[model samples]
Target: MANGQEWWRGSVTYQIYPRSFMDADGDGIGDLKGIAQRLDHVASLGVDAIWLSPVFPSPMADMGYDVSDYTDIDPTFGTLEDFDALVDKAHALGLKVIIDQVLSHASDQHPYFTESRQSRDNPKADWFVWADPKPDGTPPNNWLAIFGGSSWEWDARRRQYYFHNFLREQPDWNFHNPEVQDYLLDCVRFWLDRGVDGFRLDTVNFYVHDQLLRDNAANPLPWAQEAVRPFEMQYTLFSKNRPENIAFLERLRALLDEYEGRTMVGEVGDSHHSIDLMGEYTSGSNRLHMAYSFELLGPDFSPKHFRSRIEAFFKGAPDGWPCWAFSNHDVPRHVGRWLEHAGDQEALAKQAAALLLSFEGSICIYQGEELGQVDTVLSFEELTDPEGINFWPEKTGRDGCRTPMIWEANAPNGGFSIANKTWLPVKPPQQARAVSAQGENSVLAFYRAMLALRRAEPDLRLGNTGFVDFPEPVLGFQRGDSLMCIYNLSPEPVTVDLPSRITPVLEQAAEVGDGSLSLGPNGFVIGRLA
Candidate 1:
């Protein structure tokens, strides 16, 4: 393996949502101690690192994304010592620790925000994005919050409207303020000094909003009405993705460079411009190590869609790197999200694992994905996600996938918690696919095998890719010069001719007879060409 300096180039990172992963002290919510206890399980998956979701001090208004204090561990999770212990445990297990850092905004309850909102004349008054209302007493502009409704919240103390991209409790910071930039950088420095490996930057594009305070233009066409949140109805050109963001990234990169083996992967969340932004953010070595967009998280699983996304990114920024993920804490589980295209849940899960691991970039796997766990069905009353609650009945929200991980099928609460109630329910379906119930040839086993294969083959990990011209459902691509990866996106058998000189490398679930490769429904194959 490469030294810590370059270990992240094409590493596999498993994301653990602390609240739902495991609970120590019999608490319903998971904590740092719970994560430390589970390090062996994470290390067993053959993953290079574990990317924990936010565990910093928070009110849980947005489920930890709204951070109040960046330097300390949230009391709900554990003390700072517990976090340091987890890092030690992870490192001893040969697993790197990457944590989510939400710098775009902070909880309104944060002391900085509290002081900033006090009459607007204090030293921290410019810490948050504040603007005066329009002549008619409306919000500063037509900007809308991602959760719903207006993005601006009227503040009684400051008598100004504060900008919040998501929830009102989560206020966006004014990046134009130099002091604000220094504060955020210092917060990151605190974690880097604590032996952290990297950061998964939340809302990376939202760091620097337009200083002009201009109104976001309406969604051009086609996607205008098809949008989910009102925030999606507009292009959001001025509100985010500002040109000034790159400078801040340079500063962030400089900070990371001070550490020996630190890295950063930003989340670019623009609906239309995510791909382009990803290119710009990662093109230069002075910016993020990589950036991941929601391009693959969407429902479009066709060959063309997948091919175009990969090709477009490489074409735009040949020098940049990308981190790809099919599912994370924020979205629906891949099996449940693409259930229609999957003939069998187990088959699809294995194929998805094979496919993602075979891709030519860093990969992230959410906890429970290897167990083939689908989203648990939850009633409205059981929902805890604010987005789901706001769009009730219509959207089930993220709670379905954020349920407690099932470690033991028969154990109460799937052995995730000893408490009578978990933060989210562990249902029968999820319990059935618990780790203890998995056999030698289970989805979990397939993931381990795929990861091992990736580690053994340097070409598959850090290879240059070229798309193969296969039909609609069969997505084929070549990794470097020798390795070829093909996936049948749909639940139907497909056959394609093998390359002139080829030997099947990872064909446990694929069949090859005569001169053609036959893939079963939701099957994938990897071959090495002579």
Candidate 2:
């Protein structure tokens, strides 16, 4: 922090899903060359950094989360030289590059996992979580894989079962083993030498396990049918989120400290204790630079829901920092999830973007959010996400939010590719919201203005956030002492008296005169208090 390398603080990072970003070769798949070509567009958005999703060599079992090789780029994405050129292109455009690191698990096809499962006395046997089954011949415990079934997969060679928090093909690593920790840190050092500005650590909270082979206890609270998968029925106490992760995070941080200006934002995946973990993992500046959870990414939309979660995190970890986002590749677009709370599609997009950007800490804008893109509607056959395939109708999976970017409204495949069919079809709805079709008053233009304003004003970017004591349907907060941010989160107009006379700075369906203010549906006011 003393090195003045804290640009990540209060900065905005854009998450790029390379496969869906652009296809330079017209191969119906996006590659590093494609991303390099699109760097100019990303730079135009006023983002400080760009976070690329996993591009490592993989079996694609979990869609790149199942990493088979960590040190090289997957052929589907590109080669090491191509990645280096992409990095160079991004740097030229004044954008920092952040890559994803999935350390908790590796695809079973990885060389290490292949050897570990070959025999009980293999050189890498203890590198993975290997457990002996009971006399009755069942899994060691009730720990379940997040993709759907038992967490343990039997291996006939070792007469034991291996643990997997996600897809069974993705086996969990033995973090208790010192060699495993050393190897992963060395892999990180490999990237540090490659000139990456930072990292977006994936499944960071799942870095360690109980190691006792204990069962996961049932969830104490009654959730009814709201549970998206069977994985939600249990507490995940023994299966993951073990205490040992804190030490490993410290080790990781110390490694990053060696590189000037390197930062990390971990994704905490716990259901019940994610917020507390977000607080713990980021507290004291010795671990993550910032962390984010599903808190703001869900379907809930209200003053209370947003206020309660933001307040809870700061209260628990005063020194810690958090990153906020409204939509991402993993969830349905905010425009569709909160459609009931919105009167106009463009209006809601602008308001939600305003709220996210104005938050206290660093924020992330998922790809296509600035264009006011809505989720793509897909049939069950069109779904590629394993979670959606397993839960079918209950949860349509993440495919809707993960469609390719729409650069042209009328071009084939939404101008993503010239091929007859891309990896995932880009439908008409997404095409209609293309970047080529937008004008100066479009959501994309508003995003550029908002970002420029944040950069020009200090209070909006680095101010201390203090929420006002207002009731539901109305959200008001003070940024520092002079700037006031107010929002009406309902579909109906709500009128209120300002704390003082004010001048409207950024408004959408909002008006301020005298001491009275009128906010229409999804209305917002960022004004200077008089």
Candidate 3:
């Protein structure tokens, strides 16, 4: 990394789903104090910063994504004082605080939305995306909601259809309205002034839409097996990834630029155009610092798939920076998703961590990923994720991944909370891999070692990636002059010919190599180039 480089690039960010991180009030929900108390644990992992999910006041419809107030801390989570203390403590511990900014929409209960819907002539009337119904009283266009059903909902008071790409209660803000853009920018300023180091922009591409409200074209491959959301059926050209979004991103970047070293990373959700948009959003110094997409979070774990995704971004966006992760609140844990090829759960966890750390971009590690936590087994009755409830058998929702972090192996509820009933069940398998149990000679330990190695090795942390030629099921890449990484994503042992002059610097196992390397199922090796 260059001197005076932005802190976000090549940094390891630990994400805390506030609701599931830790509960301080015994309300079965995590809060700022709980996070403050746990800062040392995150800091001990050698991560550069923490990305906290939304803690703003919400109706919990989309679980804090539907913000009712942009400034106030939710009472359920904590008070403003608690948040201030969290910032103080995290900074004391040398951890930067990056928060989730859901700028695209607000809760229906928000004052802006309430007043916008009260009458068509109110001062806030144009704050939201409101459209008139057609002659048949149907929605103005064929846009679909990501949660399910119609993207536009009928409001009795306004007698107009409001656009909501998510839940009906979470209405999309009209970014085309200059005043609306200014107001949202003020919200960004408010947090930045309060010392938030950066923002993880949620649904960055969804910030703008086609002003003409054109219907989305049908997806070219309707017969393909898609994920949990029904919104994937459409091409989403008009509904999201609008050209107008770039200027707004520039505006956001300019605001953050006022604060020295502050940065922003956007979440791009479009399937076909995500990488291209990521490139466009982060190409220049005046735009977002980095961006992430759901491409790697999908079910494909093959070497070819991983290679293509990384190579495509490098080819398409030479100037853009990318952030990579295997699991998050939205997707199933990678361990469970790739369990068939991994053979052993423990080995797979280390393999996944190694693979993510070896990538040539910044990395995000979900809360339980350090402990090698897999998805919790959820019963139908205990599930709380709306997406999971809708897609039961084929694709159980994200609740499995959103389960509370296990801090204690034997303690009740894994010491997540004092409450008798958790919103999501913490299974025994997960509890066994709790942070306490894995503090030594465990997967968490492996993660710490790998992260420390990355920080110490300049080539691994800030080097360009060049793919080395390798056979099927074997992925090989060299980072700059020294670090060479190889991953075998197969169920059977395979022999690989190594570069004649290369020697082992770090290997995941004792028997990693002896001139010609023999790799076990899902095995990996890291060596220094001679």
Relative to the true structure, candidate 2 reaches a TM of 0.98
| Tens-digit per-residue lDDT, 238-331, candidate 3 | 9999989999999888888888889888998776787888788888788889997678897788878888888988888898999988989998
How would the candidate models be sorted by TM-score, starting from the highest? Answer: 1, 2, 3
**Quick one: ranking by lDDT, best first?**
1, 2, 3
**Residue 181 CA error for candidate 1 (Å)?**
0.4
Residue pairs whose backbone atoms clash in candidate 2: none
Instruction: Give the Cα RMSD of candidate 1.
Output: 1.1
User: Relative to the true structure, how large is the alpha-carbon lDDT of every model?
Assistant: 0.89, 0.89, 0.87
lDDT string for model 2 (1-530, tens) is: 01257888888989999999999878888888988877888899898989999999998988899999989999999899999999998988888999999999999999999999998887899999999998899998998888788989999989999999988999999999999999999999999999999989998999899978788888776882367778888898888788999999999999999999999999987778878999999999789999976799888898888888888898998999898888888889998888899988999999998888888888899999999998888999988899899989988888899999999898999888888789899988889999899898999998998888777667777888899876669998988877889999888998988777778888999988677889999999999877
Worst 10 residues of 3 by lDDT: 505-514
The runs of at least 3 residues in candidate 2 whose Cα sits more than 4 Å from the true structure, single-residue gaps closed, are 1-3, 224-226
**Clash number by candidate, in order:** 0, 0, 1
Please identify model 3 stretches exceeding 4 Å from their true place: 1-5, 222-228, 510-515
Candidate 1: tens digits of C-alpha lDDT, residues 320-371? 8889999998888888888889878888898889888888778889999999
Q: Which ten residues in a row have the lowest lDDT in candidate 1?
A: 500-509
